[model samples]
Target: MAEPFHIGFLLFPNLTQLDFTGPLQVLARLPGAKLHLVAKTKGPVETDCGPFLLADTDFNDCPKLDMLCVPGGFGIDQAMQDADTIAFVKRQAEGARYVTSVCTGAFILGAAGLLKGKRATTHWAWHSHLARVGAEPVKARVVRDGNLFTGGGVTAGIDFALTITAEIAGESVARAIQLGIEYDPAPPFDSGAPDRAQPETLEICERRYAGRVADFEAALAAALG
Candidate 1:
């Protein structure tokens, strides 16, 4: 009998719910996929939005995954600095057919030493920091280098998942999923990217990230040490 295609998303406290759910919604439809929401424990994990996601499998019980995704959120500041979490990601990457992350989740992959010497990307706000983890940062919705894949920002996780799905199953399958989910994207604003955002909008975003960036840098330093 063919082994089920195991797919996992690493869950941690305070992850942006969309980062995890957006991708899961797409990947869950993959042919014969067996999905797992893995975390440190079976207890519920609190997302940044105040909602909680229950883990079906703990790190210790997770089966070897064919594909693994780590989603980003403020929780990354904590997860990147976590030794057990880093070790778990590292160990899983050794056997995963594809190792991937979304947004700042790239930092966790980097902390696991998975992004070193790889070309990758993350949320634009944190794109430059990819270099700190020894990665050549690329700006794109999805960047794939060898078996490592990464998505940009939060909503990009869905795009990233579709890309991987196409690779694994086929373009036809991916197209069907996209149509099924109506993955058409038409945002009300053209200011999603820094290049497109107005000067004032960019300034506001910068101000908002000022403190968060500092905290992220400190966590990155400690994790990479």
Candidate 2:
């Protein structure tokens, strides 16, 4: 029998729900996978979209995981500066076979000094911030530098999880899972990315993230120092 594979997602207040749940829907199907939603405490973690997710284990009680995934949102503006969160992530990465993040969660890993000198990526608006933490940011949905993996933005986590599934279990297993989930993305609009978006669409996106980008940069600066 295959050994049990423990997968963990770091839960925090104000995370983008899609970043955590999108990947959850896919990675949960990995054969022999046991999922752990971990946080500073076994309490309610809120999402940016006004929903709440419960973390099953606190950092102290969580089992050693085979994989650890951090999900991003505006909450990351605060999470990146949290010492306990950074320490827990740093500690978990030391033993996990795969260390990964979705969207701006990469900055939390950056806070732990995990991304130093690594090729990584994050949400397009914040891609430049990667270099502040010593990461060479790439412009792609999924990027892997050794054992570290990063997803571009919220919805990109689904693709990121599938890629990791292919790496660990193989193409066949990943394909089966993708098929089972009917993971076909056919959005009615072609504005998912910055380059493809109409100028007005890009403007709205920029406006939405304008304040957040500023706050996150300040947090990132404080966290790194």
Candidate 3:
């Protein structure tokens, strides 16, 4: 039998727990696949909600992976500004067969110089910022530009994983995983994306995250220096 495909998930402090966990659950159910939660250090990492998650391995100890997944949250802005994290991401992505990001994880990838001239996506609120980092921003739920796949906001990670599984393992496997997860989704509100949202709603979201956005811009500028 062939050896199982190895997948590494980059974990950092303040990461969106669901962004990583949701896809980890789906991928773990697949046959003959190994998953590793990798962090800068092998210890418990805290999420934005204050919960702690134990990582399986440190970056130095992580084995070569067939796929690398980066999940995002407010913490990503910090990670993007981190020189050590950016260097690690660039190195790992260069070695991994496929590199992917969830939500604002694209910011980290962009910081690593992985998204240059590549089409990518991120949370709707941060799409323009993505373009500023030299990535051609696409407003899709999942944008697969070659070996680099990126998704929109938090929930889009699930869809991105399914799409990638279909490409890698096959449509049957993807469909089975989707079914196993009971993937049907119905939002009470119709405004999932900025284009679909009411002007007032978009305005509110922009205002709410304005300070965060400002901080992110400052961080990106510093990281790029």
Candidate 4:
């Protein structure tokens, strides 16, 4: 029998639930996979939008993971400056087969010093921020540099997990999982990307996220220095 794959996903306050849950759904189906929802402590963690998820284990209790996954959201702004959280990620990533993140989670990985010189991607708004941590930011839904895998924005976690699934299991297994999930995505609109969105729509989003961008940049500067 194949060895059980121990996979840990970092959970924290204000995370975008989809970033974690989307990947969790795919990875949980992997053959011989054990999933761990880890946090600084074992308890309920709230999302930016008010959903609560219970953490399965505290960092101290988690076994060395085969893969360490981080999912990002507004809370990531604070996580980047958190020594304990960053230390946990660094410690797990040191021995993990894959160090991965979704969306702004890349910033947390950067703060851990894991992204140095690696090709990575994050939310479109934070593409320029990757350079602050010495990472080469690639514009794509998913970017893989060796064992470091990063997914862009909120909805990209599904794609990222399938990519990891294919790498660890096989394309056949990945395809089967994708089929099970009915992963065919047909969006109602073509405004998912900045380039495809109308000028007014982009402007509104940019304006709404400007403060968040500033906050993240400040946190990254502190974490990197």
Instruction: Find the 10 residues in a row with the least total lDDT in model 4.
Output: 216-225
Residue-level lDDT of model 4, residues 1-225, one tens digit each, is 777899999999999999999999999999999999999999999998897999999989999999999999999878888899989998999899999999999999999989999999999988888988889989999999999999999999999999999999999999999999999999999999999999999999999999999887777788777
**Candidate 4 pairs with clashing backbones:** none
User: Which ten residues in a row are the worst by lDDT in model 2?
Assistant: 216-225
Report every candidate's CA lDDT: 0.95, 0.94, 0.89, 0.94
Q: Model 3 over residues 1-225: C-alpha lDDT tens digits?
A: 988789989999999988888788787876777999899899899998888999989878988888889999889878888777888888888888789999999999998999999999998878898877899999899998889999889899998999888888899999999998899999899998787899999899999999988888888888788
Where in model 1 is the C-alpha error above 4 Å? none
Q: CA shift at 80, candidate 4, in angstroms?
A: 1.2
**Per-residue lDDT for 1-225 in model 1, tens only?**
767999999999999999999999999999999999999988799999999999999989999999999999999999988888988999999999999999999999999888889999899999999999989999999999999999999999999999999999999999999999999989999999999999999999999998999999998898888
The ten-residue window of minimal lDDT in model 3 covers 24-33
lDDT over C-alpha atoms for residue 76 of model 3: 84
In angstroms, give how far residue 98 of model 2 lies from its true place: 0.4
Native-to-model Cα distance after best TM-score fit, residue 121 in candidate 4, in Å: 0.3
Name the better of 1 and 4 by lDDT: 1
Query: Which residue pairs does candidate 3 place in steric collision?
Result: none
Choose the strongest candidate by lDDT. Answer: 1
